[model samples]
Target: MSATGAIPVPPGKAGKAGKERFDAAGRRVLLVCVAGGFTTLIDQSVLNTSIPALRESLHAQPAHLQWIVAGYSLAFGLALIPGGRLGDVRGRKWFFVGGLALFTVVSLLSATATEPWALVVSRLLQGAGAGLVNSQMIGTLQDVFQGQLRARALGMYAVTGGLAFALGPPVGGAVLAAVGPEYGWRLTFLLNVPFGLATLWLAARHLPRPRPSARDADLDLVGLLLVGALTLALMLPFVQPPGWAGWLGFAVAAALLLGALAWWQRRFARAGGHPLIHPALTRSAPYALGTAVAMAQFGSSLAAGLVLAMFLQDGLGLSPLGAALVALPSAVAMGFASAVAWRVVARFGRRTVTAGMTGSALTMLTGGLVALWAPAGPLPWLLALLQLLGGASIGLMGASNQAFVLRHAPAEAAGVSGAILQMAQRIAAAVSISALSGVYLRATGGGGGHRAAFAWASGVCAAVAALAVLASVLAGRATAREEAAREESALAVTSNEPARESTRASG
Candidate 1:
């Protein structure tokens, strides 16, 4: 590493023709990564509209229904960090290919399931596969691109995810309408097969194989178990809340587990072991604050989206298709905004994140007011407009902020860094959904109706949005200080260069 903190480029690595060839190859690889992400993220939300059709077909019990939907997310979260670390130690190529293959095979398995229990198991495995693949995708981007080029690649990635999420409901609903109810939901799982296979083939051909590891990875069994248990402890209360006492117990367990994990990681490091997470990552102010930004944006945005879907269907009594159509404008706006976000980040840096957070907060507030005050005929249109603005804010924030956070990661630990960033978001998503939906559920049960429920939940989202903005500001300042320090050091070195030259001349 140089005094300026940049790793020096290798000799013969900067030739123009060679660089161009590498760039072209890297772009092809990027397309494969994005395609894989697009497939998995679509799976994340596609089942939302498939529940009714699913229940009717499988005659699934209430518990089965809950597991089918929530299990996927739970498994996805559980797989991220460990998978990322493993991909770092082992080559990413096999993991990416294996994970995608597993995902595809299981999608077919899910499509063939006659029993809900079988479907639940398959979905959980599928989520794990998706998690594995997704982590590699982020890590691969970090490995492949740098500087403004990285920002652009990640921007494309973030926007693709946003579009996948926004498209999930309508795509699922359209499938249901096209086919009869019985087979529609099954077919939804099958959608992944073709896409996954094509992407898998491309990945096998294009993904660069990094040099082999000198030694086998030291799989930290104890640390991995602790993290896994901690994730479950945190997620369960949100998914299957078992009264206030139970919730308190889980929270305490999570806290205790966190402390234990931290202690173990320190011990493991002192023993000269490669811990699952990099030690430097935990100490980073930039990482912590950037994580805060991602968590808030992901959690509140997803919860808000869920609330809108429920409000349209359960509250305003719109058809599934109708609700999806109303929500489509947000996706459209998000796609457009994300495509341009890297340019904004280039000009504005981290302030772009603050702007996005502020915009999100205001939009959430506006959405609440619209829910409470708009007439029935105009409610959907008005909410759609609100979502359009919200989507743009979210899109700009997601890509730029992701690039912002990952920028702080040490290259050697890039995989785990990306994993942890997303892992934080997943945990936040669980928490936000619990808090906001808990409020919504209580309000509706109290006969306050959908308007009151939405209004109260939106208030919670706005608070999270505020937190995101504050974090963004702090992160920006931290990054600025680091950059300023580097500049000063460089100037000091430059100032002594002439004196050194004069002494050499005299000698």
Candidate 2:
């Protein structure tokens, strides 16, 4: 290892075994880092099955319920960019350890909260910590692996995330059924503490601290506030039914904040100051379009899960355990698909994402039809089939979209790029869930009838899938162009190197 803390690869055949050993070490570090991400996703999904329990126990209003869920997501999304940028400047390991510590403490707080409002605050803090931890994970991966190893590591990361999300409902349901709702849901939060501590130990032992680059800039405090306010303004109306006045106030404030953020970023860039995210990175066609596609996929996928859960529990009168069992096929399929995603991407490149989105759209449309007309006796079977398709779609798209967006990103900017990608995803999940919940509640009128609501949510999922298809296609084109340009540039440099060396020798 270099004095700067970078792992130097040995040259030629003599160093081959050393390189292999280094690669193995990197994989271990990746697993440790991904554990944090897995835990975060579990935290998000485990709460789903427990929502009814929370309402009954806490006497929570609909608004309170929404906040309890959306609060975590909003804080997570809001903090990611700044968190990632902060990691870039101050060291990801430091930020990661601090974030894990905070998350563990808040998990305990969430488990102990007796009031709905108290739980909401705890969830927000927990998500803030999750954001900080997650912001650094991909950067850590980028730091350790290269070439084909990097691709496989990223695919594994995606697989872990998918499994965590898929496992949450079943795990949460089992707990709720086994221990009873009052205490079981609380145990879900408490479960993170030990896992977090173990992961922290591994990270401290395994993670390398590379020297920070000169380009690492100060944390954009003003930009952070602007983004936080912007996200809040945009997301608030979804969670709480804002009246006309409230909507107007939020809209005006959102516009003003957005404009202010843009102005500040441009001014900072012109002054040779680093913004939270470099303006160029945002403008890059492949990255921007890939981010949109990822957002759409995440939104639709999360909403679909919620709607399916409702369909099973309410529309068909299944117990939470039964519902979880019926949903298991999707998770299984997702795991299978994730395992092979890298191979598919290697051969087909961005077309894999386009194909995945297309499949997702078809699945949602099919699911919606089934929800509208299929008999309850056949509902479980049909939903399983649909989930199989949906899970496969998500598994195929998740890692590919992430890798595509960051493929052209500068090494130093990996943290910020990853932060933006994940922030968009979490934002999409929170907003879509809020909108779908509103639709479900309004459609059912707080009753057992949820067919109409399920169909509506399915339609929205279909629309999101369609958007993803468009974005993925455009992203594919942009990615191909970018790759080709990069190839040509590399050839130019390679072709000139020999000539330059020959000239020097003659001189």
Quick one: best TM-score, which candidate? 2
* Tens-place lDDT digits, model 2, residues 1-507: 221111234456435543543356776788788888887778877777677666677887766766777778878887787777676666788788888889999999999998988998998899899888888787777667877567567667777888888888788778777888678779889988898999888888877774566665566778778877887787678667689999999999999998999999988878877787678777788788888998898888877777677667767777667777777777887888877886687566678888888998999989888988998888888888888888888888787778777775655555467777788888887777777766665577566468877888899889988999998888767766766777789899999999999999999
Pairs that collide in candidate 2 are: none
lDDT of 1 by residue, 1-507 (tens): 332223344656645423433378888988998899999989856776676667668987645655676567667766777777677778788899999999999999999999999998998899889889988887788788876566567767877888898788778767777885688888899999899999999999999885456666676778878877886786567556689999899989999999999999999989988776678887777777888999898888877876676678778987667777777877888888888876676566677889988999999988898898889999999988988898888878887788778878766666577787777777676556555655665567568889979988898899899999998888877777777787899999999999999999999
Weakest 10 consecutive residues of candidate 1 by summed lDDT: 1-10
Which whole-number lDDT from 0 to 100 does residue 120 have in model 1?
89
All models: lDDT? 0.79, 0.78
Q: lDDT winner among the candidates?
A: 1
Give the Cα RMSD of candidate 1: 4.6
